[model samples]
Target: MQQRRDKDWDLSIGPDTVRLFILKAKAISAGVNEDYEDGAEHEVEFDGDARDNHHHDGLAEEETEDLTARELRELIGDLNVDEAAELVALAWVGRGDYDASEWQDAVAEARQRGNRRTAKYLLGMPMLGDWLEEGLEVLGA
Candidate 1:
């Protein structure tokens, strides 16, 4: 087993919670490119064209993705203002917007830009999971 890194700084949000967000974010990212129907089954009348009869796979996976997204949204929504801001700062750091040594400035900026739509903003990011993981690693958390 690999040795765990030591955490030398204080974080408003716990590492385990960040890991959970990373997991859910990765699931959402993976599902984004998959072909899933809009929860509808259609009977196509083909006019000698095979393209018209094309159907998407993974309805079950779509449902799971929906649930995971909802869970992630709720998790982010449930965090207090400080925790949410810290999370955003962590992402910014991970994305190379700021260095780990400038954590306090990042967190302050995040708090200044804090809003009720933190979850929505974060979920819209394509590499949220990877960024968050990188942030944690950089912080040695």
Candidate 2:
């Protein structure tokens, strides 16, 4: 992998940070689907008192929102403009929107289109973490 060009662009965010972000994104995406055996492995019977006390769903929507999603929001919110743009560019590159040879172009576009809802935009991507990881690999960071 080739190192990112220092003369053309100065990426303030490090690879480690991107890696961590990708990890969190992956976690959140994976958590979207909870797969568990329905009495396939083990079975337990509950009495009336037990059933009455524990009659809640697996996880509420609000509870799911608080996990990796909130963490990702905070992470994106804390990033500066340049860092945020770089992240967007990385995602773009990873998603094949821009090739590694067009890294500068991707970064430039990211900066131009950056907004307050970067976290939301990023979260909307189905393979965000994979894309980001690919971008980092392309950048050789």
Going through the candidates in the order shown, the clash numbers are: 0, 0
* Candidate 1 ranges with C-alpha deviation above 4 Å: 1-8, 34-58
Would you estimate the TM-scores of all the predictions? 0.78, 0.75
Error of 2 at 48 (Å): 14
Q: Give the per-residue lDDT digits (tens) of candidate 2, residues 1-141.
A: 334533444568888999999999988776654333343322445786766444545567548756778888899989998889899999998888887778888888988987588898898898999999988877777
| Each model's lDDT | 0.85, 0.79
The numbered model that scores best in lDDT is 1
- On the 0 to 100 scale, the lDDT of residue 79 in model 1 is 96
